[model samples]
Target: MSAPQIVSGLAEIADRYDAVLCDIWGVIHNGRESFRDACVALARFQAERGPVILISNAPRPSPAVIEQLDGLGVQREAYARVVTSGDATRALLAERAPGPAFKLGPDRDDPLYEGTGVTFAPLEEARFIACTGPFDDETEEPNDYRERFEGAVARGLEMICANPDIVVQRGDKLIYCAGALAQLYEILGGKVEMAGKPFRAVYDICLEEAASRTKTPLDRSRVLCIGDGLPTDIRGANAQELDVLFVASGIHEAETLDAGGAIRAEAVESLLRQEGLKANWAMPDLVW
Candidate 1:
């Protein structure tokens, strides 16, 4: 793996890529407010590049989150298309619809099952588990579901994880996601299926949409991915053989930034080394 070039802004290397695959939650917004500079950078890229596809591990379909984006001040013109983990996982749920799944995660994520013909039941009567995240993320952890999940596992119930992210930055703190529970489930001898980042389902949708938006042949080599999550974003990009730009100001800020919120190149490299990961480029934050 090559050392990541610490660039100041996306413009420094914008000309090399034909399209952009940008992550949400961390790179553009933090679930509290929009990062205006990051949003501006992506909008500019969409105007100059082939397409700016907002690929996210958000547990709801792209449309479901549009209103949240609007409320958070993320401009609609920032990107051409938005594909999310929920969009990809909906098909999985549809395939096993009416199975009387025990839907996990918060009530806010109920949009994931709309129109999918899937039915929900209490844990005892459910045939499978569909996890979006903690039912009460602010106060819950994976251990809260250990007893519940153990029973499901003994019944051979498979868990379909919508978001393959263990945790994500929500404001200034990290909160558990569906992947955290999925990890715990697997530890207890349960099977889990995921369609989000670091998985092929989400990428296939992103690239297919990118191709439709472009006028020419899609050059996968020339597409750049911008994100913060090491496992979901960077690892997914690497698996697809795509160049990735790591945003240091997100969840790994403690390891990649200093007290003054400035990028520490050495710390960033060290963190990457510890994870056995490599990025083509990295930045403190996404700015043009």
Candidate 2:
């Protein structure tokens, strides 16, 4: 494929695609607040074009995530529907119900387990591990779990990761996510399972829902996937054979943007190439 063209705004290519699969964090918001322009652009697209479906890796179910989105200033009309890894994970958790699993992650992530029938237990009495992220992402790191993971590995407990993002932008800072712990678990000879981005589970849910909303069969060629995450967003889109619009000013901005704050096409290309990935378009930030 050719190098991505740096786009000034979404309007440049809005007409080329029929629907958009957009990322929530970093694209429309940074955990602390919303990106007004990006939100407006999506609202406009939904008004003039086709459905704008949000595909997020957040550990909370879609309905619960809406509360967070509302607090962050994201409008309800910005998209047709929202699909998340947490939504996809409920099935995996349900299949293993009454597991007495060791539930990890913060209280906010508790919504992910409701009605899944999976009961929680202390590590010593647990049969498996369900991790959404560190109990306190602001203060914990992956290494902090090494001691606990060693014991879990000895028991051969499989960890089900709700979110596959290693890190996410929280305001101006980056914080650890469930995938970070999953990464560490794998290194310690433990098994990990995830159904988030870069995995077909979440995409399948998102696409199926998008198709249902459009009342027409989905066409891969006319769908656009937008996100700032390389491993999750870009890789997942590539696997589904969908085009990508890389958000240069998101989490990877430190490396993809130059001194003058312009998106460096060469740098973006080099970064994606290094990861054996490609995006059809790149923009400093999402705008109308």
Residue 131, model 2: lDDT of: 99
Q: How accurate locally, in lDDT, is each candidate?
A: 0.92, 0.93
Task: Note the clash tally of each candidate.
Answer: 0, 0
lDDT of 1 at 180: 98
Q: Model 1: how far is 270 from its true place, Å?
A: 2.0
lDDT of 1 by residue, 172-217 (tens): 8899999999999999999999999989889999999898988899
TM-score to true structure, per model: 0.98, 0.98
Please give the lDDT score at residue 181 for candidate 2.
97
Itemize residue pairs with steric clashes in candidate 2.
none
lDDT score, candidate 2, position 35: 94
Candidate 1 vs. true structure, TM-score: 0.98
lDDT at 188, model 2: 100
Task: Report the Cα lDDT for candidate 2.
Answer: 0.93
